[model samples]
Target: MRSPFRRPASRSARSTGVVRVDTRTKRLTKRLQPGEIAVIDHTDLDRVAAESLVERRPAAVLNAAPSVSGRYPNLGPGILIEAGIPLIDDLGPDIMRLHDGQRVEIHDGAVSHMGKTQVIAEGTLQSAESVDAAMEEAKAGLAVQLEAFAANTMEYMRGEWDLLLNGVGMPALRTQMSGKHVLVVVRGYSYKEDLKALRPYIREYRPIIIGVDGGADAVLEEGLKLHMVVGDMDSVSDKALTSGAEIIVHGYRDGRAPGLSRVEDLGVEHSVFSATGTSEDIAMLMADEAGAEIIVALGTHATLLEFLDKGRSGMSSTFLTRLKVGGRLIDAKGVSQLYRTRISGWWLVGLALAGLLALATAIMSTPGGQAFLGLSGVLWDDIINFFRALVGLSPQSPTV
Candidate 1:
């Protein structure tokens, strides 16, 4: 009979590393290094968060909460499992007892302190089959989420109808958007790919760039200048905050903005916009009210699964915001796949060179042109002789 303690192939039979722990996945990922163990408290981790951790390439992921809680079919755990990163879930509150940066060894789904034989925590290893099973079960729970989302939407619409309709409480901004295209970037699903494909549009139109929260960092990574940034100010890098972009902190409807302190600590000038929607929604509204000819969105959530992954009760604000903007807004992915720029530098350069060669050939067919060519040959010889003399080399006579 096979041993009951057999380990999954995805897990390292024996691995040891220093632990980096955080209740927030974004903060933890920033400090996490390759080959180190990551300890997070995220339940039903979303794709964006999972992608961030995958980029770091950690040795293993230890979660205090269930990676897939069956609330919805979250894609995070499956992504990690497929990437060949070991995931041990539901290790319980005892796992949090371990101090940060402490050396630990993992073997056969057991975690033990380095230089000690005691197993501090044990968890079941997640596999493809197991994750798929959990997801199947989780689909049933999506109905509950959908109902809740609808209720939230109704409540939000009832409370914020005026703000959604008339763009009330929008703060004044220095960036001008009148009669020009606006590019509103969010660091959401497939943002990198979508951005990569929109290079031509960005180059040609030169749209005003508005980054939402950590999306500011994404803008900077693409080597584009940020005209404005709107968000709660969490998950954005200090470098991005200091990059001279106009900062608009997203505050609650009650006028409480928690992220203002970080901006103040940096000694940067910023404005506060008290609103009742996602930062992306606020950004779209701002661009629309500023009279942007067109608004291009990159990495903004559009699907039900995406909204669910974000843990939003409903997309009521987003829905109403879209209605407010009407036909002005366009998704980056759709635009990238459809829109094509007419001119390229190489094409223009080749055309210019072809035109010049044709003109030279036409000129050479005339008598005056022949005389000019002879004169030009004589001048070229003179230039060669001058260069030879400057280099201390004797000029040789032409061969007969």
Candidate 2:
């Protein structure tokens, strides 16, 4: 039976293109080029991932997993569809069998190799109405998620209370945070605007910068130096990993750190902090334990929907970390809004120019000032004549 969302078979539907395949959406986006098809295994694709994919301008997206799983109203699929990019979902794990950079044709809801009559896999086309219905259904499931989140928070707190209090597994670092301000940046919602707003504060304070996972790239994008980077390191770029920042790989309490291998492969010096919390939470705790006077957070998730969208089971560590940091942690939005740049060098220069102009205006209104000006003009003409004579030119004014 034909799906309601599927368009009638057309010449464009049979369009053939080279396919770039990756289980990781972020990695796939990096390799995806314009006019090429993107094959990914991402489920419940988030907004940031969607934005990245949209920026690449791919011809179409082929997902091996459901783009909208009704877990949460993830905006990824909606974004692609709204941007006029065709999204084919649930092609099954068999789609991964397709070789990367291989030419493939997609038509009539089926994917096939170029110049072949055999269909490799089939998927349903996703549209605006389907995505909207999934989102509505997902909203109804939020209560269940909230309950589960609360339960998980309690369980996590019970297991990791000691680590939170004593700062266990936090390796010593060369970058000192003692009695200084620390800026913790996350690549979450409104991060760009928040970072832009904190420009003045960053310039004046020169706080220690801690980037969490993909947030490292965000810091680099803003042309800021990273003092420390904390995360599992899966989403970060190779450029950011080798950017000379102090790396603290987030490890499991069992002493197994998946991200450590990548750091070791790069031959970079790093430390490990085995804790049971989000990378952002660990970063904040690290700063507080290191004696930071104040900590400013950029792009940290605070809303319920944000947490759900990220597919976090619970925010126990986030809640507890905030409690531990207390008033020291300030939101970037608040800092940008409240903090104003003091009189800068340019402002002083402007003031000096204005004062000089005012004085000259007052001076010009006096008879003594007019007489001085007339005398000064006579002296200026004499100097000009002297220079002209030296150069062997006529002293009289030259005709234009």
Candidate 3:
């Protein structure tokens, strides 16, 4: 007989059991097979992940993990269940060893295994009758934080708007950025350690660079100019505040503004946008309304972690906003069409030869040749690595 020790290439028929999906928001937003249990790991990202999960609206969203075990009022599986999808939270680790399609049974919003490898999850027990109810509670709980965010944001906004409208300072880094393709880069989940690849394009197109809140700080740290900044002002940095970009504050929908006073203290110009959604979103919307032809996205979320970090019903509005601007959205992550020139051993060799020639010429004239070569070599390496990672998604750019 053949050895029985070897395993198959993919999921075997015997282990082909369905995974139980317990969450209501993510996995349940779309159609899910009978056996697949949705895996949930809601980390501190944003709603960008919903872009992917919203497509599958599964039978149930197995909140492999939920915000505060579903105790804290938030929009996670809570919204999923309201959409008629079963939701379960805190399913524990054992649930991970499941296939995409599998059988499961849920009771009291918890897991209950039924058959061979068949698993289930106990969803959130206090099931709200409607999404509105859950959303109301979430909004109520987040009210304090939201107000603080609003106050900071509104103050920043009034200042910037005053500058832009009154032409007080002309947005420190403002240029004729009207016809450029503006890509508002954020330091969201995927953005961490991911933006290294985008520098070349940043140098190439030189679009109107706008960052949301601390995204401006990230840009400033990267040695890039920021034309404008937008957010509730809670997470932005002082460096960004003084970075010479126009700031816009996101205010509360109810007009109970909050973040404005803080902006006033900083003495920055701003405009208030009373809306619901992420600041990255506000940036995109502002760009779109202001007549940006193409809006490329970098460090945007399309995963679970980002949405959870927000812990707000803003995902609902974000969902609709994306649809409204779907055609204009382009992901620039690991993409290279915007860049020119390829880096290879041959190009490096050419650069080396050029450096030698330049050194020879400079040395012939004076003793400063070595110093010039050193400076030029450093600059060339930085430029080359930036484009290389822009094409290959390598971490080599920022290091240089």
Candidate 4:
């Protein structure tokens, strides 16, 4: 009979690394190092989490919950596979029992303690093919997901109609947004690239900059200061919180603010705005209510798949918020495409020529310059006459 404890693969295929375990993938990624194994309990992991893991360059990922639950085509699994990272799916709760910094061997689908041959757990070793198949399955179920999304949107509308329509409960702000551009940054899809692309626009327009949660850190990383920091205080750094920005804490509709304590502990003054929906939704709403002439959104969700990737009913509010903001709001991704540097080599050359013409006009006003011009005119006529003689045509006398 075959051995019940048989390992999944031969010795040559085994991968060995120290495993880091965490219930929260975002927290785990902070300390996760290159070539380490990340054991996480994230269900239907989102694209941001997967990108964070890929950045850490983990040897392989072991998930306690399914990465793709087929609710909709989440972009995480395909991103990991595309980055050449190994992913082992649905390892069960037992995988979380593994201690952090515990070295382990992974062969095919089996995870074992290093230097041992016994299998500790096993899961489905994902490939490009398997991930593609899961995505297709998830795509087929999108209609159902959309129906649920619509239902959630209606529920959200009913609950937040006053806030959405009249900007009810929006707190007053010290930062003057009226008649000015506001740039709201969120640490989401292509945020870094979008931010880089917006440098020229930011420099020219000098828009009021607002950072949402960890996007505060992203803004600081780009050497920009925040005029206002909005969101739950989670995921943002102490440095960013203490950076003298106006803090607005997003609280639940019921008036409980979970992130309030963190800001309080830091001794930073802040205001609470209670509402349903994501923090980003509130950020945009606040800007619109404050009479901002234009609002530029960076790294915020804009597509159908992105809304589903959030795996929350709050995304419904985002849809409603967009409509409320209307023509004033523009996604930074689109801005990056449409915005140009405004300054060009031709403009510089024209400026230089204009300056030279002005300088020449000033010099010609001087008596010495008038004498120089007369000498130049006579020299030019002599050269023209020599040229005409060579061509057998008499040079016309200077106009009297």
TM-score of each: 0.85, 0.84, 0.45, 0.84
Q: Pick the candidate with the highest lDDT.
A: 4
The Cα RMSD in angstroms, rounded to one decimal, for candidate 4 relative to the true structure is 9.9
Candidate 3: tens digits of C-alpha lDDT, residues 92-136: 666665554555555555555555333443434434443334444
Model 1 ranges with Cα > 4 A deviation: 1-9, 339-343, 351-400
Stretches of model 2 off by over 4 angstroms after superposition = 1-14, 190-193, 338-344, 366-400
In candidate 3 the C-alpha lDDT for residue 68 amounts to 40
Q: Where does the lowest 10-residue lDDT sum fall in candidate 3?
A: 3-12
Report lDDT per candidate. Answer: 0.85, 0.83, 0.56, 0.87
Candidate with maximal TM-score:
1
Considering TM-score, which of the candidate structures 1 and 3 is the better prediction for this target? Answer: 1
The per-residue C-alpha lDDT of model 4 at residue 28 equals: 90
**Residue-level lDDT tens digits of model 2 in 225-258:** 8888899998888788899999999997777898
Pairs of residues at least 3 apart in sequence or in different chains that clash in candidate 2: none
TM-score, structure 1 vs. true: 0.85
Residue 116 lDDT, candidate 1, scale 0-100: 90
**Per-residue alpha-carbon lDDT of candidate 1 for residues 318-349, written as tens digits (9 for 90 to 100):** 86777788689998987887656566889999
* Candidate 3 runs further than 4 Å off: 1-177, 303-309, 334-341, 344-400
Measured with C-alpha atoms, the lDDT of residue 311 in candidate 1 is 65
List the candidate numbers ranked by lDDT, top first: 4, 1, 2, 3
